[model samples]
Target: MAKTKNVRQTALEILDAIEKNQSYSNLLLNNAIEKNQLPSKDIGLLTELIYGTLQRKMTLDFYLKPFVKNSKKTERWVMNLLRLTLYQMVYLDRIPDRAAIHEAVEIAKKQGHKGIAGMVNGVMRSIQREGLPSMDTISDPLDRLSIETSHPIWLVKRWDKQFGFEKTKEMCEQNLIAPMQTARVNLTRISRDECLETLKEEGFEVEKSPVIPEAIRVLKGNIASSRAFKWGMLTIQDESSMLVAYALGVTENEHILDACAAPGGKSTHLAEKMDNTGEVVSLDLHLHKVKLIRDNAQRLGLGNIRAITMDSRTAGERFEKEMFDRILLDAPCSGLGVMRRKPDIKYVKQEKDLTQLSSIQKDLLGTMAPLVKKGGYLVYSTCTVDEVENQNVVESFLAEHPDFEGDSSFKERMPEAVQPLINGFDLQILPQHIGSDGFYIACLRKKV
Candidate 1:
């Protein structure tokens, strides 16, 4: 279905927009793929080129510096083209050097004059022939790791302080890797075992999720377009995100609230866990996203969910105190844990953003804490590894609200794969841990 010609050119355009227009790589790439109707093979190459170049930007630039005399003076599109070519030369062993170099030269000539085309050809060939510069040349260990791993130095230092130097290095390395495509089984339609058998019969390669019993690891093929997915037997989601519903520990016929729910991933899971007997009041800030939640619920044939368009902060005023049996505050954060999936976060997220996000996270925690009935649980989660967003925010809320205390009972709902990650009453899953997204979940209970 994809236009076979000019695939590399498509990737180059995407890389340029990602930096020039401050566009998100994943979102832009998806839009391009959908708009162009790319075939699966072209999709694979396009995805690899865009993500590999962005994930290893600094490293590729370092390798190209010696060859390009006017590195900074180079045009943005030309720079992007060189980086994409260099990424293939360095990381993609399957792509031969000559083909990559030729394509870069051709793209350069098409997009610019012969002069820039010659320069692009020279840079790519020289890098391939001369080999990359050694990262050891950098004096500071932090700087060396940052450049080699293509992570920002400030973020690296912060993680180094939060999680020791060794752990930070491992986490940074893990962030460059691609995440697995995971899906959750809709138990309302079929059991996990039955679903797995069905998928196998349909020629899909899959395995049970280590963290979530209801999830499966999509080893091959796009699970979203699978027959099971179209039939509403499963939904595409990461095991780490699916863990939230499991941690909520829903049973039949209980009232629950999902603050900041959108697209209804966790809300639907909570409803299914309740066997469609209880109501899951899902709240989102945007009306379109609320519609998306409702659409997802209807697609999955789960009618127990009630989607609402309201900010969680105003939820306190609208709903009675202690109205919900359980509340989930999956607050927005710096999104540091999800860097592997969205590498653009490495360049755009600053230390100031973290501070602002921490404040918002704290506010959401305090606002949602009261909504949980006494003896009920409030789970605070984020797809980030930062201490300020996870531990510090939860600790601040616990101190301010004497009625709320850390709840350990939630662990009973956890699988054995994540038991070692338990810290006091919370669980912090770093990227290196089990190779999932960097996620944090803390459980709090109302004491009075």
Candidate 2:
């Protein structure tokens, strides 16, 4: 009979799959953990190993290069084993170096030859004795920041140029930190205070967001597994994202268009803010995603949302021009801002992706712009910090479409703490500032 793989072995396989197939790390890890039926403790270890190793891939490679000569020539599985083992040694202080090495050697023997096992044992010992090479040797500031933070050098350079050295460094460091599990309370069902009291009664350490009233930050416990979440009293979302509904400032019984809406977090939030009385047309490009939006709405018991599988670029063709009272173009972006939750994005996204995504964002904005009725609100948002995709796109749109003007009054609807962050109609929420996903929101109003 084939041997049952241990947690380390399972983690190595998942990492190997991520490297070989370029699969999403979170999805792959969750599927593997469920398939193996790992215990809670082992599950935690597996998660750390996979995410830590992938999050610091470049740094791990840099540290391994001095020890493992011809690393490129080594088998991909062997290299991943080395990377994950080294990650435990350097970052995870709870696991002893000896135990980590032992596990790696055993996993190596089962997966590879005796020679690979011996090499794994030897390299880990060498790393323990010699320690890692100095990062100070990297002369270029951008290159050093990239290695230290395990972000792509090109991305670091781009951020450096845009946000300057200190802010770029802070953003990179923030990305490496694990994101808090924040959820927006289903205000249509329960008030924020009532939800907090219920969560506290259930022994969860929960706190209301200072900025977004409906947002609750789960400080401890498996929030998704709780009765509150199962009953759809809460929807997992970042505080920054929850603010998009507020930016739209919808009224009761108003018509709202959530262009490019999928999985329906913002759409549901819009419906909740409108007291479940408004019509929220949620559109996505794929049928599967439209179903996902519908599922979320059904879970939250939100009847106001209508999920439609249609491309945002072709929104005007299906809907009457200037039909909606409010239009939200939460454009697809490079996803640089949410890297804390999705570290794999740093490796997968390229420099050219920004230009390509910006073009798509602008096209979506233009397509959805006409759908906002006169005296209606239009809000453009992205989960990216890129200037071209956020500010530049809005600026270019304003230049061509003179009918819409920046709406500064949106700030008045937001928390006073966030009011200072708003410059005219645009607000850029950095992850470090709000301890949430980085987001850019721009509010515009159609001329009456």
* Candidate 2: segments with Cα more than 4 A from true spot: 1-5
Q: In angstroms, give how far residue 337 of model 2 lies from its true place.
A: 0.5
In angstroms, the error of model 1 at 121 is 1.1
For each candidate in turn, the TM-score is: 0.97, 0.97
Local lDDT at 273 for model 2: 87
Q: Candidate 2: deviation at residue 134, Å?
A: 1.1
| Model 2 TM-score (2 dp) | 0.97
Please write out the lDDT profile of model 2 over residues 1-448, one tens digit for every residue: 0222387888888888887887888899879877988878787778888889988999999999999989979999999999999999999999888888888888888888899999999899888899999999999988998999999988988888899999999999998998888999997899989999999999999998887777888899768878899888999998899889888998899999999899899999999889889799999999999999999999999999999988888887899998999999899998899988778899999988999999998898888888889999999999999898999999999998999999999999887768888999999988898888999999999999
For model 1 the local lDDT of residue 344 reads: 91
lDDT of each: 0.89, 0.90
Cα error of candidate 2 at position 82, Å: 0.8
